[model samples]
Target: MKILIVGGGMGGTILGNNLARRLAPEMRAGKVQLKMLSASDKHMYQPGLLYLALGRMTPDELYRDQVSLLEPGIDFEVDPVVSFELDHNQVKTKSGKTHGYDILVIATGSRPVPEMIPGLAENAETFYTEETALKMFKRLQAFQGGRVVIAVGVPHKCPMAPLEITFMLHDYFKDRGIRDKVELHYTYPVGRVHSLENVAKWAAPEFDRLGITYETLFNMKEVDGANKVVKTEEGSEAKYDLLITIPAHKGMEVIESNKLGAGGFIPTDKTKLTMEGRTNVYVIGDTTNIPISKAGSTVHYQVETLGENLAAIVKLGSPVREHDGKVFCFIECGKDRATYATFNYTVPPDPKPPTRAVHWFKMAYNKLYWTSARGLL
Candidate 1:
């Protein structure tokens, strides 16, 4: 059996490594072949971009050679797929090669589209990618004191990033002794500060305690960069001297061009984790239109369930696992403290207060992510 994996993001890496370990004997016996195709040879720990923006981590620490993280039995390549001819059980790659597979897993992932909002790309600072994070860091360094506004959009990755950055900004300006001079304000699209009800409930008081002003029901329409104002779809405006934004996200352009799913996200079965209308093709991570937070833990958990089911299919000729929508995230609260949220489909998240221990553990996990990707943790 030829198992082809597309995209080398978090979901792809873990799933590739997991499958290699589970099907090692089959691979050795020439019964199963696992191969992965990615856009780059370097694998990035994406969550570290948040810390990179805060000057807590460096660029060198965020990357590893993709080959170093995979198990021996898996074949890895840096060529990206340009066309997905699912009907033929094949994909055409940029390298002019067509790869066939019995089972295909698409984890092409998502990208933030600040350009979608008029003038947002030129006006606001974002930390979603390495280039943007570095620019945002420099912007923060140059910012002395003014109305610092955080504008959030929907379907973005790392759901807690806006709140985490807000708290971090409070600490940042406080450290610079400009806390009194800076007016930290946050605006959200929905009526609540967060999509998660309990998280929104927990964040409100935390914002109050930190003296961070916020306005909900503020959907982004466009940015008046010259006037230093953000016009919302609701017809309200937020004035700012410095604007930080968590822009909306969409799946890869290849997915869009292929007409896989709306906005590039592939329609996926919430429980089976398979692409709609195709049992042999699977979807995970930011690629899936599952209406869940597009966070790393979501990818991590989905890979776990997929690895088990794929292995079960090889061993039992049938699958026996369902993704439970499990997700976990560590929310940095600044002040060297952090908290976490864990939830599944049946259970809602109830976050606890920030603690230094959890913060340190999150720090440790940052280093251990490579091990986790190797299917060792």
Candidate 2:
């Protein structure tokens, strides 16, 4: 039995470690082999990117060598996946290598699509990636703002990140004595500040208290970069001296090229975590069309359920476990305070108010995340 895992992000690396440990007996007997294929040697601690813009973290701290993060006995290859022969259970890489697998796990994850909106790629700035986050930090520092807008296209990873950045920006500007000089604005496609109604309700008062302006149902249509303005499909316009936009997100190109599902996302069984119409293939993380926020917390919970299910299938010929779609998010409120929320697919989060202790907990969790990825925590 051979397991091929595609991707080495938070979900892929953790799943590889879990699978390596669970299938150790088979591996020792030469009955099972585990290999991971990643596009790059870098595995980023993405959650820390939020703090990177706030000067609390650096780029070096957010990334580790991907091969070093894998568990012992797991083979790792650094190559770009060109296509997947799903019917044949084989994957082709850019280096013209083909690999066959008894079981395949697609954890390729999501990426920003700035090209989805007109003028967005040329005009807007973002902090979703380490490169972009650090660039935005410099832009924020040098901004002599008239209007600063934080806008999202749609369906981005880390549901709370834009809000956290908005809060941090308020603090960032105030500390620099430019709070009143800059008007902070946030725009989202959804009708609420957050996807969850209850979380949005909680955030309403916080937005008011912070003096941040928020616009709902503002589906960005185009960016007039030359004029320094943003126009939405709903016939609204905002002039921004500096624009920070969370570009539209999409699943991996390999998935799309193979026609796995609409928009490159696999339509997966929410509970079973298996690809529709395929028992030997599993899908997890942002690659799945699951109605959950594409956050590391979601992946963290999915990993345990996936590991249990995969273990059962490999050893017993069937899966007895089901995922609960549980996730938690820690929202930074700046001023060294943060709020925490926990929920599942069936429940909406009723977050606690901001607290300084939770802020420290979030900071501590960043260090724990590194060890956790290495399967030490």
Candidate 3:
């Protein structure tokens, strides 16, 4: 049997690596073949992009060759997939190659589309991509003191990133002795600082302690770059000297073009992690339209059942598992301190207060992520 996987991001890499390891015996016996397709040759540690924006990590340290992360048995293709012929169980890529598979996994996560809002693409600064992160770093370096706004867009990959960057900015300006001169503001589209109500309750005190202005229900409508103003859908507006935004995110154009998405997100079975109608097709991570944070930990948790279910399908003709929707994240609180929280479908997140230990743990996890890519952790 042939297994085809699209995308080489965190979810894709982790799933492919884990699956290859689990099916090693089948691979050796020529009973299964695993192939991974990616649009880019470079694999970026996405969370590190925040540190990269803060000048805490270098570009070289944040990226690796995509081929280097996979085991020897898995086939890696560096080609952009243009279309999916799901009816035929095949995928067509820009390289004019067609790959057929008995089972297909669509871990092709979401991508940032700043153009969704008028003038956002050309005017606002972002840290969602390597290019944007590097650009933001330069902007941060030159920023002396003024109104700084950090806007959190919806359906973003890292829900904690806006808060993390905001806290880091507190430290960044404070270290330079311009903390008082720089007025920091954090704007969220949701009713609170975070989607998770409990997490938001925990973060409120921290934001207050840091003297950072927190604005809720501020959905962005358009950016008046020429005026350095961000206007919300409710007609509220804020001016900024430097605007750091997590622009709206959407599924890849391919998924939408292939008619597999509802407003750019794939509709899947939350319990079984399978495509709505397609048999032998599965999706995880940011690609799914689940009402949970699109985070790496979410993928890690889903993989627990996803891996088992896929294996069961091959051996038992059906899956016997379900996704728990477990997700957790460490929120940076500046001054070398951080906090953590865990949540799932049925439970509310209980956030741990800021501590130096959690901060260090996050730092260590960045290194360990490499191990995870190799299916070792």
Among these predictions, the greatest TM-score belongs to: 1
Per residue, candidate 2 scores C-alpha lDDT tens digits across 1-377 of: 88899999988899999988888888888888998999989999988887887687988889889878888889999987898887999999999999999999999999889889999888888888888888888888888768999888777888888788888889989999989999999888888998878879888788898889999989889999989999999999988998988778999888898889887789999998889998888898999999888899898789889887787778998887789899989998885899988999787789888999999998899889987787555
Which of candidates 1 and 3 reaches a greater lDDT?
Answer: 1
lDDT of 1 by residue, 1-377 (tens): 99999999899999999999899999999999999999999999999998999898999999999999989988999999999999999999999999999999999999999999999999999999999999999989988999999999777889999999999899999998999999999998899898889999999999999899999999899999999999999999999999999999999999999999999999999999999999899999999999899998998999999999999999899889788999999999995999999998889999999999999999999999999888788
Which residue pairs clash within candidate 2?
Answer: none
Reference-based lDDT, residue 218, model 1: 95
Residues 64-129, model 3: lDDT tens digits: 898899988989999878989989999999999999999999988888988888878888788888
Question: Lowest summed lDDT over 10 consecutive residues: which window, candidate 2?
Answer: 368-377
The residue pairs that clash in candidate 3, if any, are none
In model 2, the number of clashes is 0
TM-score for candidate 2, please give it: 0.97
